[model samples]
Target chain A: MSNNNALAARVRGTVHVIGAGLLGASVGLGLRERGVDVTLEDQSPTTVALAADYGAGRLRTAQDPEPALVVVATPPDVTADVIERALTTYPNAVVTDVASVKLAPYLELLRRGLDLKNYVGSHPMAGRERGGAIMARADLFVARPWVICRDHETPAEALALVEDVALDLGATPLEMTPEEHDRSVGLVSHLPQVVSSLLAARLIPASEQAVGLAGAGLRDTTRIASSDPELWVQILGANRAPVVELLDAFGKDLASFADALRDPEQTGAKRRIADLLSSGNRGVARIPGKHGSSERFTSIMVLIDDTPGQLGRLLTELGELGINMEDLRLEHSPGAQIGFAEIAVLPEVAERAVTDLVERGWRTL
Target chain B: MSNNNALAARVRGTVHVIGAGLLGASVGLGLRERGVDVTLEDQSPTTVALAADYGAGRLRTAQDPEPALVVVATPPDVTADVIERALTTYPNAVVTDVASVKLAPYLELLRRGLDLKNYVGSHPMAGRERGGAIMARADLFVARPWVICRDHETPAEALALVEDVALDLGATPLEMTPEEHDRSVGLVSHLPQVVSSLLAARLIPASEQAVGLAGAGLRDTTRIASSDPELWVQILGANRAPVVELLDAFGKDLASFADALRDPEQTGAKRRIADLLSSGNRGVARIPGKHGSSERFTSIMVLIDDTPGQLGRLLTELGELGINMEDLRLEHSPGAQIGFAEIAVLPEVAERAVTDLVERGWRTL
Candidate 1:
């Protein structure tokens, strides 16, 4: 590995990581780990020091010279401005950014007359609910999709450099236009956040007893609502137009659903409920499977006794059959005699596992 | 514990669990575990057998006599009918029900001319995504709230028996009216499910490239969308009125938000985003603190390098501080220098932990 490092000797020029927040610091740390000479700069002295202490990069003082690559990992509001600054500050370097929403920044860069030849716009679709340089992770990008938005004006060399960085971090690089990226994320990312926040907002006035009764469903839906308000303010604000359009469409569907529920006729109500429920079914079908594409799995229902070792025993039996379980659900009735355990497994092995359990005096349903 | 078992024997009697599914079976198993004589009956013979095989209770044939307490653990659609049947078939037993939605079944019981004196409507707010008797757990009700809805006509003996059953299962018992319970759940439970399903539905048509970019946030928000459609149809249908009302309110708020975002004025757009984001702030505040009531906790931002042992080391340090982390977040930024680790802890310990980390070689922000 050291010989491989020697073969890929550091380019004489330094790599400048702008903003020095979570994304910026992560990029610096990841590149430094790969034997790149990285210099970090941030608007906040405290953030710069924090990133430096974590070995993200050496702190770049104001007098530091130009670099080969400049990664701008600032907020959406300032990504374009920082990118433009990097382009001017290091005329020989390639400039890139890690921002959630891409179109606006890309447009702003073009309007500002920065050399689009040296710039590439990208978004690494990975993040936690937290923020700042303190949470930088070298492997945060691994196995995640890193979207690169390339326009007709984007230079091939610059795009390749960005893709190389993405691959180095163990991410899959996907190419999309800025417009497509925005609209796509509007449905998959921003819209969900807005919807989650809206639902969570409803609980603000809920009674203590009501809130206490909250179960996993509510927890899962509102998990993103616990995100940093200030950061979301910027993200949603920047992507407001696309998100609003999606929410508007969603509101129409919700209205239709509400009206159907309010109808006195049972047929229409049941039909509407089924339709809405079926929509969810189709949506679940579209989500990528464990390894990145959708594939159907067989579901098996087993009767499990309410005992400590019962579940362990069931899992052990299935494991012995070498049946890889995809998903498992344990349903509990409040005062029922028994519960049903629904397990999802490979279709080929599901029947064998079921037959095995049944043969062992275990009830299979 | 053996002495406790002797004390429990003093109160043992024939416990009739009406529904033989997961909750009902679990109740039977719990009671049976405590040496209580449990007689389980279900509308369907298959379910009854499954519950019996899972040890919910000994299947009670038609010739069996009525038990002391009857637990109606059927689905909401048939809960009232089952309650009525149990009352008519075993007139001597004190009857209670375990339904997710309470008001409709309770009202239906009233309409069917059942003896309200012998019946107490109860809901144990616990369940898995799947259903059936095979998944029952003897401790499913442990430490969770078992709500008993009572009216002026309800017999004190019936309420006492229900409370006894709940206590025997180590559940906390709370009292409420059917109306209050329904509305409370509308805000905290049903509405969130609809919202999650609706959001998940939006992802059906998302581009494969975009879907590939999905992170943990999308996963969390849509986790509940995978719930059984047939069961949700019954749940949403039974509680249609309250759920529709809440959805209508949410739609209105969402519409207002959409209009705000579409406004051409920058200031107005930003103000709207701020409103939506701030709503989340208040919403998160209303959620109960981890394992307790609603209380604010301090969130510490820790800088984490994307390395194998980095997270483990941070957790170890926190454990050494005797600080129990309430929540955690990992923010992933593509092509960034570092990831952010947001750790939620008790407010009193936040400052000390931050200082301790800073004093050690770690950065705290």
Candidate 2:
């Protein structure tokens, strides 16, 4: 452990985590790994016990002392209520919640006339498609953005405590107001979820032959539609306004595109279509690559048979060639004995890599 | 070359390909590998010369006899005109165009009062994000769907020639009418492209922080939106009717979903949202998995430090354990020194695999 990660020494006493779900258990597990005294709880005794059994934390008891900090990691629907209760129950404890949406819970607490001085609403922009204690890992939060929402009335110590915890869990601390966090997630997370789900839903009515014509494009666009719907409902409802606005804007773009295509004979109609498509290129360009940079890499596809050692051998050969693969994707066609390993490398090396591979009796595309 | 692949013997004479783009060059290379005499042409002399130098095919000579088969592999916008020219130039030849959208080009030929008895429309459902001769590979169409459009007036010999070419290139030929082919691709390919593009375009105006919050979901959904916009514009415009209808229907779904979430407390509103999401689940399940089977696999995430030999070691260990990975996806957190390798294995071996991995000092999440 790094010296900077001695967060356990900073906290005066125990850290109690309410709700032993994925985020809560992950927080507990990460903090406990850093030698923090962590206690876990949940509405269901089984969940808390299961989280404890997984080395997330020990279960709280009547004999235990009051916690110095309380983390409420519950489902979004009950986040406000839980945070309200946590602040009241742990009078001196700094309380924070890891709900995906920020504005709703903060506004809810304000509406309830709760003094929010001790509470710092935060969201750790980290999760797996599947959730629960069983899926929790100590490194889940590592390097992910942990957005802390603090008002002017919020105590410096409380914000520092939350930031320290975020850092201790190996997360990058980002400060954003509740509204900013909600809108940001509304664009990035919630909007994409709805679009993906709706795109996949269209396939429900399509013919089997039509669906069978599905390629990598359709598969990619609908991949996230497989996420849990119950969790999404709560999230979407929490961040309704921003997501709705985004949907409206996106719907207009779709409609306008359809109009442009509907009458290509109109002057500039074709250009409009090209413009919309190009806009997509520009928009996707903004997304950071794996290294958090927008710089692109050239992909070289190498064909391999569907055998155990083929990919390993190819990668081993690539290593021998002194080619640093920036990214790797394996694509297998339906009912094919062949697979394609699409390796992304710096553009400058792509030509040489392809030539070398082809010369070495490997087929590349 | 396999003796059974007597493509040279079957062709009787040269096969001419009119576009030195990815698909056309790939077809040329695959056929060339099978010992078929192939002639290449393109709008750009340099493109054709480069494709020839790459061994895709040789340049046609003035004294060369008429091609036995002429494949019109032009851009989507000019596919029909090129197909007509190919048919007129080689009257006895079996003419085929490998354009993406079938019905549009087919209809255009009919409207021009040209006899298309020798012409067959086909689409090899294969491409890379980046196109051109440089990106071409011989195995591009291997096991990929190559749709052939045939009508009652179509001769058996002409259809057989096209099917043979598809087979010779290791593609699976599926016969469908022009209308059916257009509609199928409209749903499976065109609709998803539009949706993905629109979703991605929404990100163009988003804050940098919002884009930073993008995860695998956004990445997956927008993956194909990075495709060549110029090529897509021609495709979307050609298949305008069916795609418009799809977008309209999808728009209604999005509108209803937004409305449901907007007033989720209303009777059956929440149920409506849940039903839509569940439909997406069922729809995605209908997509054939790798190797044409819908067999699901259990994925286990293993955490590893981002270092050389870590992934190779994991795969090597997996081989030692006699575990066949169905699929593998690597995810790295931004600025983190650790990564997660999500390995998909058959459900039966998942439990044992996890246990054995943990015992071997590997962290399985």
Candidate 3:
């Protein structure tokens, strides 16, 4: 108890958190679990105090020594100001902000001509549908990508400290330039967000019967449309350059596809449409699923009858066979006692699993 | 065994299947299971023979009586010709073709001045990534929507015959006019397919690093992009009018959204973006999940340690608690022994589940 814990030893002195919202509070809780002393500050005293009560950290005071590191987890619009203030106030401490966009704030700081050697910009690819200090959890950042932006002039020690924090929170730290980070996120995160929002927005004017006919396709495409708009506006605004470019490019693709589909007889129209759709097939195949090497997972269709008893027994037998079911999707007809379950498992065991199930008198597709 | 099965009682006389492909072979397989006399026909003799050997149906013989009902399950482009051939040959039989696009083929048959009373247009909204006789399942249509178009002049018995076939195959039969069906499918299915394909096509030029950062959102939005291009061309071509209109409307939505995102300083620009996103929220809320009433499902996030034992024990306790998990999403960082498992359950039990989990020494978000 007298000695410093593993993380506390390297993270000397108090690690001050300047914003006690979801990201800030989560960072405090995660670090505190590693036995580091965390000091909390927020614009709203009640919010900061609530975070403290929840074991995030206690409020900082004048008597406390200058912190070794300060984490600015404020909203994206105010990130540059917060970082500047932290650097000005704590002259000796390292400063970092968990802003989604890395370039805007970095450029703003550069424009101010402040000595920003201590500042490191980072963004954690993790969030929930709702945002608040109450929604924060110690394990929130675990297994997520935490992108760390570094400059050529930055000292190696400052970069290491931020990476250490990310690792301590159980996140994989990826290093990228601010430009690369913004562009990459614009493609993977911001672009998808805008597209999903637009797709779901189309549903507003649809008839109940039309919406009722919606299957997994529409649902999956629009799931992220539930994200808070105000928060997105801030993120998208900060990364407007890359996001606008991506949206424009995506729009052109949409236009060409529609044109081809509109007049399929206009020489090469059908081929053009097929070529674009085939590109989509190749593009989708590149994404990594939950297991990382997602291509390794294969789905086997198993026939099922209306009797509920068979489902229970099938699950039991899968477990008995030592098959770790990756995912399961069931198709059951309403008022009809027939359907099939599409089960996903590792490919190495897929054939064997099918054979074993068939030997036990199960039908597969 | 000598007597007709439950379904065969209503579906009297021989049922003839045309095309002997995924949909047609599946129809035969399902009807044969009910002891209905089913005969197979296809342009390709080898294909028909393969389907027959698979026990879908036997080849129609010269001595056999005319089929009571004929099902045409050809490609959308050839659907009209096949339906015409079936109607011309089986003059007295009730004829229905399972084509994805209803209006175009229906109009084509009407142009030929064929007898209007005996033909019903239907579509089964069920398919696999790949289509063939081998991929056909007896329960392929189970629990899915089967849209049937009927005109005022059609006989009730002809409509009932088509509906009965859908029911026997474990599908829910829905009645809609050709225009309504075409427009509804354009909104629910075709529009999303084009959007998803175009969104993913943009990824073909994306950097490997950017693609590597892809998450569940990107994957979900692009999943359907892997669909067969040839099949989509035929479906889109057959339903071009409605689909083109939808795509054009969706393009306008994208343009306005991009303009708002591009010029945030413009009056109401930010508000416009927010409103669109908020509309998306409302739109997504209306989609039904696997259980039909998707709103009933609430996800509970549970914190898990790096230890493998904790997961096993968690599953055991969940079973012990009699909590039926609707879905599970695990967020685990590679090389980091910490993550959270998001467990979805019915909302009625969510509170009890959290309480029980906490009492059992499990931490939940």
Candidate 4:
């Protein structure tokens, strides 16, 4: 007992990251990078071997010694079973699970009479369109939000360990209930995927020529549509309640928009379009600016020619003007003579940047 | 007259692109890059002078000699009047207008008994989130489609000149009636903006803490929501009818989805989500692969660490593998131990690249 306290005081125990998939392997790799001893495991021996081979973690078998913390990184469908098994298998270790949706697993654990004291539920608000262990990276959690859904019964030590892991991974931790996490994710993540996919689906029957004319707008709107169907099926399935509620409200707005369009005289159509478009303005205002600040961006337009090196020239000129571009976009019409380059800058720098560009003999509109 | 025909025979007369904004300046720049003699005009002396300064075209005043073709590149609300004025001012010149919506101006021209023989209506399927003449580029239309709406009365010479213009700008030309063009754009362009804006609007009421946690999924879904409100307001206002119709259909689907969510036990909800998701799958299928081909992309996942040089190393290694990356994405979660890196390559080369990476001791999941 004295030795245990001594070890805990000097260093956190080895972290055992289970599954060796994107999240699991990343956890192991990140902990290892932080000088924490990490052991990686997976149901598939080949996967476990591959993960270790890639330096995510050292391999650990079921019979291996218990570690200080255990992270169950698996699909939502199986997270609960994995967590229960981990708890039973490593009674001395603090346990956690990183899954997209939370309520179901938490409920399942309660039903199974698992020790709630050792387990903290977490959802890392980061992911790519691809999946699997191969996609794991040590810095995946850096600067992103990690939500910890804590219950009253969660042990303080376990919570502290998890927080330490999150901090070590360079993540900003937020605290919320399982329900709040589910609802928030439903609105921000799951609903957007559904909407994007639906919009993309509309193009299925489009003529090759029409589809060919697609620009960055369609690409951006449908990017999430390319996500794996099976995984999303599970995600949407688990978060159906909140997702459904959000979709319903969206439907009302869409219906109102449609009604306005169908008006014979355009009076109602203009109002509807105005309302919808204005709503977007308001919505955009709510988004945090780059680097988590809320400051609005000022857009400046620069005229560019339809020639090679022109864009490079403009960017170089902007660099020379000392304009730190927040965002940049280009507008071109097929068979048109010129292209428009729109650059977003911090609101404060917008006027100076515009004046500098104008003085440099570049058109600013 | 002989000199005019001679010039028209060997080389097209100078195409004057008016307004020099995103659309107008692009037209001039595109033609000039194709070695066509082009003149640019705009009401604002500063804008006209800037276009000349950028080499998009030479500045021409109202008193200047007419060109063979004149493109009225202006805002939608003002396009018809410009077209009418251009026709009157340049009686010998063939005329066209580049606007987002079509039916309104065509109708207005027809009602005013303008010289339809010299004029055609066109909408280029290209744009950026930003606006204005200064953002113009010469190759913005490269490989994109330009839709030209023509009636029986459109002069053959006028149509030919417009087609030449589109080709010169490196755009594919498509012919359609005004109604067809409006309906098509309504589905592909206008509807997507409304949906995106509506989705973004939901974020307005969300807690700042939650908004700060957003990742690329939310960003992609809401990117277009940051579009210029004044310009969109004009586009939406003009194309209300068809946009409304599409939104109604979307609303119906959304309602069905909501019903399914309200009762999870019902297969209806499962089917709804599945159907919506599947629709996205089908829609994604319609998008052209990289390099404007229809081939499927092969996706590969690689594990990366959070260190500064880790991503660069992976990319460099992939380059060493002789694998050309078509697209790449990274997912970073705040307060987590790892991240994900997804890469897309040609389908035929996927396995070879994956094997090479694995041999190089990189994790493949």
Backbone clashes counted, model 4: 40
- Where does candidate 4 chain B have its weakest 10-residue lDDT segment? B330-339
DockQ of each: 0.29, 0.68, 0.53, 0.34
- State fnat for each of the candidate structures: 0.44, 0.61, 0.54, 0.48
Identify the leading candidate in terms of DockQ: 2
- For model 3, residues A136-190, the per-residue Cα lDDT tens digits are 8888888788899999988899899899999888788899999999999999889
TM-scores of all predicted structures: 0.84, 0.97, 0.93, 0.82
Candidate 2 backbone collisions, by pair: none
Q: Evaluate model 2: give its TM-score.
A: 0.97
Per-residue C-alpha lDDT of model 1 across residues B184-221, encoded as one tens digit per residue: 88888889888877777888777777776666677778
Docking class of 4: acceptable
Residue range A270-354, candidate 2, lDDT tens digits? 9988988888898888887777777788998888887766666677677677786767777876787887878888899999999
Q: Candidate 2 — what's its lDDT?
A: 0.85
What is model 1's DockQ versus the real complex? 0.29
For residue B306, give model 3's deviation from the true position in Å. Answer: 9.9
What TM-score, to 2 decimals, does candidate 3 have? 0.93
Query: Stretches of candidate 1 above 4 Å error?
Result: A2-12, A59-65, A264-267, A295-365, B1-12, B264-269, B295-365
Cα distance off (Å), candidate 2, residue B262: 2.0
Rank all candidate structures by their lDDT, best first, as comma-separated numbers.
2, 3, 1, 4
